[model samples]
Target: MPEPTYRQILYASRSEAGIDVDHILQQSRHNNAVDGITGLLWHDGDHFVQVIEGPESSIAATYARIAIDPRHHDVTILSDRPVGAREFGYWSMERAGKSMQDGAVMLARLERRLTNAPETVRQAFTAATKR
Candidate 1:
């Protein structure tokens, strides 16, 4: 059989005030599962940094929707590339909380699992938290 192909897209955005993270997670988890996508999302009150992985077509469609969502602005694509494997294979759309402990754990896990992640992704995480 041919090797499996996966695409990873990392993006950052500014979320509107009063946005509900739980609601977003619930909707995303359902939609992503149906679309065969997996990824992680981190929100720090004002900003969001997400990493999505899946088939090329699915990733493209999902990101296009996100880019136009009225809930966020200043959407920026940090990285988009083909990958040999899924870094976040288990979760459909997990959310990393805004606590220091949560941030540390998420960063460590990403470094360990996706050692080849681009510097832009790391920088996005930092920028999200600092905002």
Candidate 2:
């Protein structure tokens, strides 16, 4: 097979107290759109599970920024690998959370997104959303 052109990073983190998730989502959408990145960000009240995928350079730069962001702590990487194509290709940054009014719908969509993801990545999201 040909080499993968995209890099994907799946990670989980503990959200810092009083951090504005709305602001973070807004900022991420803008940045990811400009940088040609796409992914899902599932943030419960106290934790985060995300899957970011894009060009190799963009993914590297984006992950670098995320690594130093103050909104979250203990940013543990669940998976880092390359893919031949984008998996979460529909959104620049889609936000999912149990706090939403349409949470069941959001979770169903999230399950679809993780349908082909690694078991560990899927489990991380499952655990976080359940909390």
Candidate 3:
């Protein structure tokens, strides 16, 4: 069978007070697997930068749920478009965060993963890392 038409979204948001990143990751991994979605979610204690890709309908439904999630505030869409293939296909929901021992290592890995991503998406991740 031919490859499914994939849609990807890059978005950023501020975490609400006392938000649990681990809980979000657990839920995302489970839901994304069932929905055939794959992507990364990065957090820096206060903010989030994520890239989710999958079938158009799944992406739409997932994002619709994200947009209204009370755990997030100031949600912003950095990029939204159809893609030829998954840019973050290796993980159902990989995560990077300040919780890591070496942020530089995480940033380097994120940069490499985004090597095939759109320029706008790349820029958004770069900016998110700096924050």
Best by lDDT: 2
What lDDT tens digits, residue by residue, belong to model 1 across residues 52-109?
A: 9999999999999889988899898766778888988889998885585567677565
Q: Can you give the TM-score per candidate against the true fold? A: 0.84, 0.79, 0.79
Displacement of residue 28 (Cα, Å) in model 3 is 0.8
Cα lDDT over the full model 1: 0.81
Q: Output the lDDT of residue 10, model 3.
A: 77
The alpha-carbon deviation from the true structure for residue 16 of candidate 2, after best TM-score superposition, in angstroms, is: 0.7
Q: Model 2, residue 116: what's the lDDT?
A: 70
Kindly give the stretch of ten consecutive residues in candidate 1 with the minimal lDDT sum: 107-116
lDDT of each: 0.81, 0.83, 0.82
lDDT of 2 by residue, 1-131 (tens): 77658998878888999999889989999999999999988888888888899999999999999989988988877778787888789999988878767667766755665557778767776676773
Candidate 3: deviation at residue 96, Å? Answer: 0.4
> Whose TM-score is greatest here?
1
By lDDT, the candidates rank as: 2, 3, 1
Query: 13-86 in candidate 3: lDDT tens per residue?
Result: 88898898899999999999999999988888778988899999999999999999999987877777788888
Clashes of 3: 0
Clash list (residue pairs), candidate 2: none
